[model samples]
Target: MRALMMPHRIVMLAVAAGLVAWIVLTGNWSWLPKYAPMIGQGVWRTIWLLVLSVMIGFSLALPLGLAQASGPWYLARPARAFCTVIRGTPLLLQIWLLYYGLGSLFPGIPWIRESELWPILRQAWPYALLALSLSYAGYEGEVMRGAFASVPRGQIEAARAMGMPRRKIFARISLPLAFHSVLPTLGGETVLQLKATPLVATITVIEIYAVASRVRQDTLITYEPLFLVAAIYLMLAGLIVLGFRWLESRQPRRAA
Candidate 1:
């Protein structure tokens, strides 16, 4: 508990209090009541985008990472190329490519535009989701590839010696350890992904950043809306850190 009162933490608290006081006393919030519902919807959209993208990306990343870490050349080469392309490209460019490039192209395809799923495909959110999911998969795939590789070879040998099936060994041992090893990294990446959510606004997905933009345009007040957005992000990031810390604490600790 004493750790909570360190100099840096105290300074952070003071700064936060100062910000709150300024917002309450000096900032223009007159438009908030009118836009509150929109703001709420925007926040929900941001959260869902982050959650869905991370889930989908992590799911794809497992196979990608496993392939890169342990698969044969044929499989590994493609996996490596996929991750390389995703990681190498700028996320904004990818978003634009998906939204402006692929998105525009979809309508020209006779079968695709006429398909049942075309309605969903034509929406901006789908492209945003795909871009974000691909981005998260690209970065986390590298992390998971390293995590999988970092699992000691001795564990595999031991499992083999015990006559365990390959799938069982991976399911019970390797996968769990690899995931646990990278949990902290996963949390950090989630925060980064949260920050990246604002980019979706470019394609017209009305998330919190978009809501802030609306507020700025309507009220002609820049700092207040942006300040609120920053505060909200900070709160969200803090919650993620706390959640990860709790998860870490739940793991068994080695005694000195």
Candidate 2:
């Protein structure tokens, strides 16, 4: 117990010392306290967008993934092709296309012609969510499709031999096993999506990075707010990883 205690104390002290050194070098703690609320607001926006996009992406991907794996080639092949194109393109391009390019093409879209939807599209948040969700869905669809395909042929055959309907076998055996097999991948994708949230700031969405940039611009300080934002991101990402690790641990270990 004493051995562990000493090392932990030393690490904590070292971290505290490093932070003090950073504050001394930056020389703008006063400004931080003033604009801290703005930063918090930006973080709130980021979290809202992240959660909304992830939920929407996952909800759409599941059915699309299952369809890709089990539907006819006419449906599956197109979905596969769509996924390929989306995954191949950069997300920034996708955002631009959806927000600007498409808007130009359909200037008089219904419910958007001098209407509320136009205002929504003109803002950064909706476009950010749209781009993030669509991009994530494309990647997640592939992961789900692959996971579904990995269901053991033997088990499926036995279920069929027992006269189980396709729907029953899929619901009872395939979906559960596929989810378990793909959990780690899904966790990783979620992490990637979280990281991508910062990119939305480029479009004027006041995410963490955007708020930090505003601070930098106003205070003419280069690194302080950026460092703080980085720290916040690291902490949030760590929590996500820990949650996924807990979930993974709770799952029964497969035979070696």
Candidate 3:
């Protein structure tokens, strides 16, 4: 296997090296140093957007996922519909709806406009966050639902036979197993969410992509800032993959 993989690995490394060389030779390196702080802030904003959205999304996803996996139609139907709608629609449209559609209406509602929360409601960031979070929840909820369903019925039955309380069975056996099962999917989803953060730029959130655009506009040196932004995203995705690998390693390996 190692012998077969060696040639592929070498080719990949060569391609990567060549791309880096091309970028370095062609890119505006001086602009990079000058605008590094602004780019860094953009990276921070991207990270912040991803973190906040994923955290809130996953929080909402848990209950929705449970409801989706549950036996009752009443609970499952609404959850399924929510997932369908949010997942079906374009995220960009959702952001626009929240930022422009609802945002425009906020001032017309006298009570909402007068309230302290109005300031927060009026900001592009809040709307962006809401749209992204809802999108994440819808997608990740399905992942969670499938993960829960994939858990071994035998193991759950064993727990029940042992007189474990329902909540205890879920906390101790079901939820953990499901989480472990879905770890890779969750990691992929997180990376997708990171990619999605750029969409917030449409709503004036000023993330890494937006900063890169601004830099390009200012310098008229197109590839450098954009390349740097791509590199940053690649680094962030690498870190996420590494984090997931570390987490997976920490868990007890299941029997073959």
Candidate 4:
């Protein structure tokens, strides 16, 4: 296993080195220095979108996932159906539906149109945030549900036998175990959520992808801007992976 893993790691490093070398050799680096500030702002926007959406999504996922996993039919069924619908549908469609479809109808409601919140609702960010949050919640909720279910029954039973309250058992044993089990998966989902930020560009959020697109249009150099954006996203994903790996390492190891 060590030998096999060593070779795979070497190959990955070699591929990354080759790509960087190629980009440096062939690409125009001048544009980067000139537009660094704009690109930086775009990157910031992308990061904001990812952080806000994922935080909101994960916050909501906790309860929704628990409901789906353990609640009565009245609660679980609807929660399950909500997750199914959001996960089954394409995210882009959800964004469009929220941004354009519902946005168009907002004016017909005189109260909403006249409210102070109307200014916020008129912007693309709120809708994009909502859509992304809902999308993340739908997927993450299922992951959480599965993780919760995968907790060892023996642990819960032991806690109960000790006369621990249900809430205490859940808080001390079940939630932590499930969370540890699902941490890696949640990390992967976060990376995926970062990728999904590009979709907000369609609704005029002006994120990294949007900035790259503008650069391409203005300079008429398609590949350069795209390549740069790809490199940035790759770096961001690498950081996210490393962060998760560090968290995983800090977690107490399971008994053999």
- Which of 2 and 3 is the better model by lDDT? 3
Would you list the C-alpha lDDT of every candidate in the order shown?
0.92, 0.84, 0.89, 0.91
> Model 4, range 170-244, lDDT digits (tens) per residue?
799988998899999989999999999999999999999998888888777788889889989999999999989
Off by over 4 Å in 3: 1-15
Report the lDDT tens digits of candidate 3 across residue range 1-256: 5764788888998998998998899766887778878888888988888999999999889888988886489999999999999999999999998899998888899999899998888778999889999999999989989988888899999999999999999899989998888888898999999988999888888889998888878888787777878889999999999998999899899589
Q: Tell me model 4's lDDT, rounded to 2 decimals.
A: 0.91
Q: Model 4 reaches what TM-score against the true structure?
A: 0.88
Q: Which candidate is the best by lDDT?
A: 1
The C-alpha TM-scores of every prediction are 0.93, 0.85, 0.90, 0.88
Badly placed stretches (over 4 Å) of model 4 are 1-22
Ranking 1 against 2 by TM-score, winner: 1
Model 1 Cα lDDT, one tens digit per residue, 92-191: 9999999999987888999998889998997899999999999999999899999999999999999999999999988988898998899999999999
Using TM-score as the measure, which candidate wins? 1
Alpha-carbon lDDT of model 3:
0.89
Clashing pairs in 3: none
Quick one: RMSD of model 2?
A: 3.0
Cα lDDT for residue 54, model 4?
Answer: 93
